[model samples]
Target chain A: MLAAGLLALSAGSSAATDGYAAIDGGTFRSVLPAGPGIEQVDVAPFRLAKTPVTNAQFLAFVQKHPQWRRDRVAGLFADQSYLQSWANPVVPGAGAPADAPVVQVSWFAASAYCESVEARLPTWYEWEYAAAADETRTDARSDPAFRARMLSWYARTADTPAAVGKGPVNAYGVFDLHALVWEWVSDFNALMVSTDSRDQGEDPDLLKFCGAGAITMQDKENYAVLMRIAMLSSLQGAYTTANLGFRCARDGDEP
Target chain B: MRSIRRLLRAMAASCLAVTFSVTAQDLPDDSVYQLQVPLRTQADTASTLDRWRGHPVLVSMFYASCGYVCPLLIRSTQKLDRDLDAAVRRNLRVILVSFDPDHDTPEVLAALSAKHGIDDTRWMLARAEAGDVRKLAAVLGIQYRKLPDGGFNHATIISLLGPDGRVLATTSNPSHPEAEFVAALRATAVASKTPAAP
Candidate 1:
């Protein structure tokens, strides 16, 4: 109860209500290959939000930056379905609660919201790194229990709306990393994988790509994380969906 | 003398205002020009996508150092240019923006332009800020990812834009201009020639 009271007090003062948790960066093996025969990549230290941005916080953002409001935002920056769940341009009353994680937000809108609070969206690597943790262990993808929990959450439909911070905190003190809503990363467009991307040299059209080749998955066994990458790769930046929301990340370890 | 200079400045500002209002009048709400990307062209001049707004344009993204498909990308557009009649060709502009802006500096872009015999009058090779590059690619529906080898894996797509920045059509097969893409180009050319309703 005391912790809850303290959290509310913090929420009233700044954007960091649940607060930001510091994650020590190090070399981590990712499901996606960095290069041929390279499965591990280095990550730098960063602070991440404890929970996803909620409807109430986003409503405040839209009110302050009217240009981001659904009616006023440029079509080039956001699509037709942006903020579709909202009852009005500014209110989240139609089934969306103030405490619920904001959904139906485009990448641009999400980035803008992060900017308003002096932070930015987490990159694909940062998100992947933080999400690999469970409550007790920093990297828990190896544990059967963790994988089972993730699979169960993945099975749940978004029909039952999600309220932010309802899930258990992970080892890094982050909440709702999974089993809630998929997120928007700052480098969302960088995951340019095609259906046959695994066959890199098949396309004769040399002008198509200027680099090594299309990215192929490294750890095929990690289906849960791979699914996230696949969904993110398929979306355009202007697209918004009912089950997509985001959180912010900042450089360094200052709370 | 100072008063006269101030008066000249005022006159120049008014003329600029008039030009902006005229260009802004007909732009569509969803036009890609709504994005304010700071671009640097091959000639090292600062510009934006809308600089070519008054003409029909063939737009694509590429890097100067791209080994394979990028050359074909140029050839495909050149083929389209070759197929067009002289009049339509003159009215059309071709823009190839670089996805690897860090490596594709103005000097490199200029050298590539010179080697390809790209007429600066009709074609522009350009690069933009990294953030702007992402936003531009987003608006154009192009996808790209930088590889660890300092190369990029990207989608090969060429888009056709009307006079006011509306995307008329796009195709992954730039080497072979589809009949529909050609027809859209023709329509855009005709529209460009016609005066505004006002």
Candidate 2:
């Protein structure tokens, strides 16, 4: 009985360390066009969690903030599938390990979790800059081998559940950016590329954007990055999915 | 039996009183007003999003410098007002908050208000802090980004909020008002005017 209780309790509380590593930000070429004259995007220095927040950590959070529990969370903040994988509101079901990265969470829930820790979600530029690194070099986009590895992960079926810290850490000590799951960025909605269909001979929704028209994607060949952008832009704030999780970032310059 | 009936009436009256005095603690868990962020109106007054809590509101996000779509958005809102009966329209208010606070200051908002001939009595042009802007947009489901030309690319949506500050309906069809959306607005307007039953 004691062993069973220990196991159940283990799935609710793990190490409290948020594992934040400071990232040095600079001007970098991004696949998304940096508004006209700006040739490169400039990211400010910030600290990112070395790994995505875990199921155990989130369970503890939900237990503490009952308003965020799946059963009690307001419809304005989350959809029906929010926390659908959990057996109960406070416990992860079978096949869900304590150390596995938490998935099926809405942007609001993720933001609240970050706030509870006095942190925030990483902006798109900051996340992209951090993920550009490999095990050795900081900017590994020119490396064909690095690109191939990232593409292979995308090519594979994402049905397999991911556990945190299993993959090799990058040069900045950040882990599982590409291989684990699609992470939520703070400006997910800001990636609007216009999908209004009324004006187009093609699918009207495809061209239905307001303002200066559809954002011209820069590096079209970078399907990996473009796919992430498409996925992020398509979702609303209250949406959640099986293969989407998030990590937290802080506004600090510490390396 | 008469005493029992009188006691129930008294209990119901107390419930009505409790609802009327909606303290901060009484705000619904799902209320958009729970955001608790400050906003400045074109009148140079500081208020939160829930200031219009006692009335139904049509809320959207826009920037003052937006040349094309914003004008259409304003025209659409005006059209919505025209579609409603005078009685229903009287209880309704329109709020257009700016996503670009850096450019859309109170002075800029006031200028746009004049340029558009916005009826200040029913319509408000407001700006919130940058941090609050994101939270407001998230609640309203409006997405926007600053462009290289100092312009913005955004999705256009207008949401209808009931008196308690919960979203009653939303419409992305700014140029053409949907019949169902207008009906929801009319219903909310009528509902707001009705006295609380005790």
Candidate 3:
């Protein structure tokens, strides 16, 4: 009970300030292949939201942009389950705590929200680079304890996600990147093209893809990140799920 | 002879322009035309995605420099066009939007159109800004990524949109057109002409 009270207090303070953290992005080795013969990806420095957008923030967004409201949104941009957890169109109510991260939002709806704030959804490379850090080290992906903790989170299923900012902050001072929810990246659809089809001379799926080659996983042991890629690739732009949410990123240092 | 051909193309373009302006306001919520993306055609004319709104549109994305599957995409689309009834074919429009907008200028697109022998009246090679291109690809469920070598790894799926810009069908295997997709195209084209028939 004391921990819950402390969390609520921290959440309220952070919600009032809702700032961004500057990430000095450099070349990072990713699990997903960047391109043909490309292993390491160069991500430009950007500002990422310190925490996921919460229910209270999203509710305010819908109130201002009526076109993005659940009842008024175009069918092409959101599915039937968009914001379904909310008590009503304008209220988050009990089932959705205002401090908890907002889920059940389609990629288009998330993109629109970020655009409203003068930001955009982070690209896959940017998201991965930011998430690779831990509380102490810039790149804790090589640490066995860190990998194990992330894998355990993937194994456990929670009925409701805890409030944002309750988890440990990474080296970049970002929170809830792993233990909270899967995020919607801007280029989610571009992640899973099969690169092996290029060498397989008679590959039947050749017509389905064009140009240089397909993508191959560079780091197979990073199953947690690989799972995120698999999940994102399987989803369409208009799809919404209970455990999927997003955060915003800016192009340069001007957070 | 060249002047006559240019005049015919101009006449067709004007007709399409009139049709688009008339129906621009009442687009359905699910219509792909709801996306306000500006396009530049191979003929150097400014256009939008809804330029051929009242006609059945065969839409796909490709880069002009692709040596292998992109060419097959055009050939397959041409083959599909050949198989359609002449009445349905007349009302069908094909727009292949380029993924590499920086390199695919009007001159490059025009050269590609000439190489493919594409009819300017019914076929258009268009390019949009990089951001708009991504949005279009997302709507059509097409996937593409730019390689370091300047070539794009992209999906070769061809989507058939009805008169209202709703995706009626999509076929990934463009080399051998799916029978169901062909039938859907025929039905949509015939149905679109029904309200206008006397």
Model 3, A65-123: lDDT tens per residue?
65566766667778899999988878888989988999999988888888778888999
Per model, the share of native interface contacts recovered reads 0.56, 0.41, 0.53
Q: Please write out the lDDT profile of model 2 over residues A1-255, one tens digit for every residue.
A: 999789667655333234798888788988766664355888888899999998888998776565567876666678899899888878897756788889999988888888777778998888889999999988898778888898998888866576788788898888898988999998887886533322323432232345665566676666778889899988888899998999999987543
Name the top TM-score candidate.
Answer: 3
Greater-lDDT candidate between 2 and 3: 3
| Model 2 chain A lDDT-worst window of ten | A198-207
lDDT at position B49, candidate 2: 78
DockQ of 1: 0.31
Quote the positional error of residue A177 for candidate 1 in Å: 0.8
| Tens-digit lDDT track of model 3 for B1-198 | 223333334445644221111123356667888676789999999998889988999999999999988888888789889887777888899999999999999999999999999999999999998867877888899888888778888877899988889899999887676799878987875588544333
Better of 1 and 3 by DockQ: 1
State which candidate, 1 or 2, has the greater lDDT.
Answer: 1
Q: Give the least accurate 10-residue stretch of model 3 chain A, judged by summed lDDT.
A: A193-202
The prediction achieving the highest lDDT against the true structure is 3
TM-score of every prediction relative to native: 0.87, 0.82, 0.88
- Predicted structure with the largest DockQ when compared to the true one: 1
